[model samples]
Target chain A: MLSAEHITVRYGRLTAVEDLSFRLREGEWLMLAGPNGAGKSSLIEAAARGVPCEGTFRWQGEDLRSLKPALLARRIGFLSQKNQVTYAYTVEEVVSLGRYAYRAGLFSGRDGDGGAAVERALEMTGLTALREASMLTLSGGETQRVFLAQVFAQEPRVLVLDEPANHLDLNYQKQIFSLIRRWLDQPGRAVLSVVHDLSLARRFGTHALLMDHGKGIARGPIDEVMTPELLRRVYGMDVHGWMRELLAPW
Target chain B: MTETRTLRRERFTPLTCLALTAALLLTMILCICVGSVRVSFSDTVTALWNGAFGLPIPEGIARNIILRVRLPRVLCVALCGAALSLCGAAMQGLLRNPLAEGSTLGVSSGAALGAILAVATGFTLPGFSFGGSMVLAMIFAFGSLVMILSLAWALDRSLETGSIILIGVIFTMFSSALISLIITFASDHTRTLSFWTMGSFSGVSYPHAGALGAALFLFGGVLLRFSPELNALSFGEDNARHIGVNVRRVKLILLITVSALIGVCVSIAGTVSFVGLIMPHIARMLVGPNHRRLLPASLFSGAIFLLLADLTARTLLSPIELPIGVVTSIVGAAAFVVIFYRTRKVRR
Candidate 1:
């Protein structure tokens, strides 16, 4: 399990994430929910040790900082919102990079074959058929899937997704979410993702942590934290009623 | 149609490298024949064979032309080509930008400035052959590269490709301006320095060729070892970092290694632009983007390109001797335009 206690992120005098806390356990899909500028990303980035923050962020029992970057990479695979790939790397080549942590050394040999793990990741993301296809030729959704497969090939115990579905169409979103769902079915695995879509958080997440103005307003079971009353209070609107109102004509 | 698809799909193989090597040797022999005093191919080869093994001299043009002048110049140009191309590929891979070659990145410009300084001041580090200017060139190359990269980072945190290349160009101009200032003050050395900046291998002797060859092997091997890291970095630094590439460390090592290789080249010759810039794209088109294969492919291709370019330089107006940099710059500028648009196309 990965957990953060009273983590706060600040840029100069302005605090982006103010003492927010959350923990992710095995088999749990924890949705980090918030409206715009709610510090959801700041919290996730802070926990991932990508930003300056003050708090206790632990992986299992050890301080996450105590682990070497390469060691920590093996434990948690991060799927950032964007991966800039301008070169003509094939699908297989991109995925094999997930094994970088395993094969990295200053004078390591040229035997950089990721082999079975790369293949499995490709299969899991339904990219095996396009293994030789260049990343340049892939569509937005396929490109996203390629990146997902890359992290999956890393074989991490915990997956940290930063809006994995952003810029993706609805069907692709469902497909990506379903792939992650299946991944979580495996033993000794957990998921923590920043999600803005409340419906997705409610549907796929077993627990929810809602934030407003850099403050965690609620944290508990998905049903408890994502309730209409709390959601309206945080978002300053009738969350469920407004969504239904927009969908009525459709 | 099949040829296009085959070219698209083909991975650079060891067979391709071997074939290029053979072609490079043949071209070099043929190129050696086409100089001011045209020696026949058979005589050129005989001269090379006899000269290489220290056999008894066969008098006339064959001996002096093959052994003394043409051989060393060809070898120097070829080594410079390989080093420039390899450094270009490494820079492109590290920065993930086609525009990130030595000249555009100000590394070569800085080396040129250093060489010009050595020439103007009559400064040469003792206890080294071609050591004074080249040593200074290497130092300045590293210095300029660090300056350009830091300036780029300061301008933009994300280090967008366009912004970085812009900084490099500005720095190159700045350095060139400084070089002109030095040449203006010491007008007597103007012609030597001007022709030198245009980049010709006329000045390269056997010792310079030997030094360039040595640097090629040393720095090239160091670069080749980082191919995997370079591959990871080509995608982006964050992805590289997440996958456990010490991006900072790898960038630093690659920067120093490439700058040294380029510095050695510029000091020995002049700013031989575009051998590094244009050759990688050609090699990449044929071989794909696996740096392991691409680096060697670029090396062979660059060597061949420079040999041909040098041949054209001397033969195009035989005895007039156009600067080799002129040839590379013409091709490189056009390629830069095409790449600039293509990168824009990708953006849309």
Candidate 2:
């Protein structure tokens, strides 16, 4: 279990996320839903330790702050919204970076376990065919999948994703959702994802947190927290009927 | 996909690096052979071997030129070139900018200011007669680097590439202004300062070469060991950190190492410009951007490049040697234009 309480993230004077709290248990997917500038990314960033925040992140009754970064990275994988690799490295080489914490030295050839992890990540992301392609030359959707493969190769117990579906096409987006679903089926795994699409979140999230302008408005089971009343109050619109019609196709 | 395969085929291998090293060694021999007094190739090799083993050769001008004049100069050129090239490669990797070089961060200018101060005030250690000026130059080199790093740190922003480079360029301008101020006031030493500013390998001796070669070996080893980290950093600092690399620690180490390298090169060769800037790009064209191969290839190519430049500087006008900085600047500027055009064309 990962427990975070009263997490406040501040950038200088402006508070990006304030008085946020959430508990993520194993085998759960907690989808963060909010409008633009609603502090979802900041909250997820704080949880990932990507930014400084006033909070306690405890993993299995141990304070996460006490763990070394390498050890923490092995337990939790953080994938940011921006995933641009400026170099012309091939997909295989980029994915191999995910195994850095496990590797011994610079010249130590990738051992059996590292190679297997990279291969598994590539296969899972359906990128085995494009493994040899240069990352600089890949399409935006393919690039997103490539980075996803990189995070997957870390093989962490908890995945913190910030807008992981950005720049992905419809097919890859669906594939990403299903992949997250399959990953959550594992016994000791959890996910904290920031996503915009309500339909996809409704289909996948077991729990949800709704935020508006740096404050959490509601938090509970997915169906209860995502009611039209809360949605209209947060989004400043009555979208109940429109969402129903749009989600009807699913 | 097939294009990637072809690129892979062209990718640098150990054999390629070995061939480059061999070519460098051959070039060194040839550079030693061609000078104001042209020694034959066979005579040059024999005299160099005899000098290396401390065996006495015929007491003639050939032996004296090979051992005293050509040998030390060639070794100094090679060591300084290799050091600067490695520094350039590491700086570019650390900054994630292809244009980054030893002088880009104002280290060379800082060292130049230090050397000018030493010359003007006649700064000298009483007991230690040799290389007092060099020690001061290195101190100022390190000082300027610390200034740049601290400025970046104080900005309260993450050490993003753009911010660091911007700070570095500002520091470069600041140091260059200081150096010009120093040069403006000193009348008697103005000539010396100007000559030093324009870099040369004319008066270098064996001890200077040894010191540079040793420093390069020690620091170059450390830089090479960070190849995997560099590979990660090429993606971006955040990406590297997400993969468990301590980005701050890696950047600090690389910055310090590259600064030390630029300091030593500037102290020895008096701010030989553009070898560091252009050699790595040429090496990357031949080899891929992978540092494991790029490092060695760049080192060898840099040595070859400077040794040839020195030879040309000596022989271009048989009696009056041109300053080595002129040759390197000319070659470097032309190469930069070609590289810039090609890169832009590729992007388009």
Candidate No. with top lDDT: 1
Task: Assign candidate 2 its CAPRI class.
Answer: acceptable
Query: Which stretches of model 2 miss by more than 4 angstroms?
Result: A105-112, A244-250, B1-14, B59-61, B123-132, B142-173, B187-196, B338-348
DockQ of each: 0.49, 0.45
In TM-score terms, candidate 2 sits at 0.90
What's the lDDT of the predicted structure labeled candidate 2?
A: 0.79
lDDT of 1 by residue, A103-178 (tens): 6456654224456777789899999899889999998899999999999988899999999999999999999999
Per-residue CA lDDT of model 2 for B16-112, tens digit only, reads: 7678878988999998889878888888888988878988786654887888888899999999988888888877777666766766566787887
Model 2 DockQ, alpha carbons vs. true complex = 0.45
Cα lDDT for residue A2, candidate 2: 82
lDDT of 2 at B128: 42
lDDT of each prediction vs. the true structure? 0.86, 0.79
Work out the TM-score per prediction: 0.93, 0.90
Candidate 2 interface RMSD after superposing interface residues: 4.6
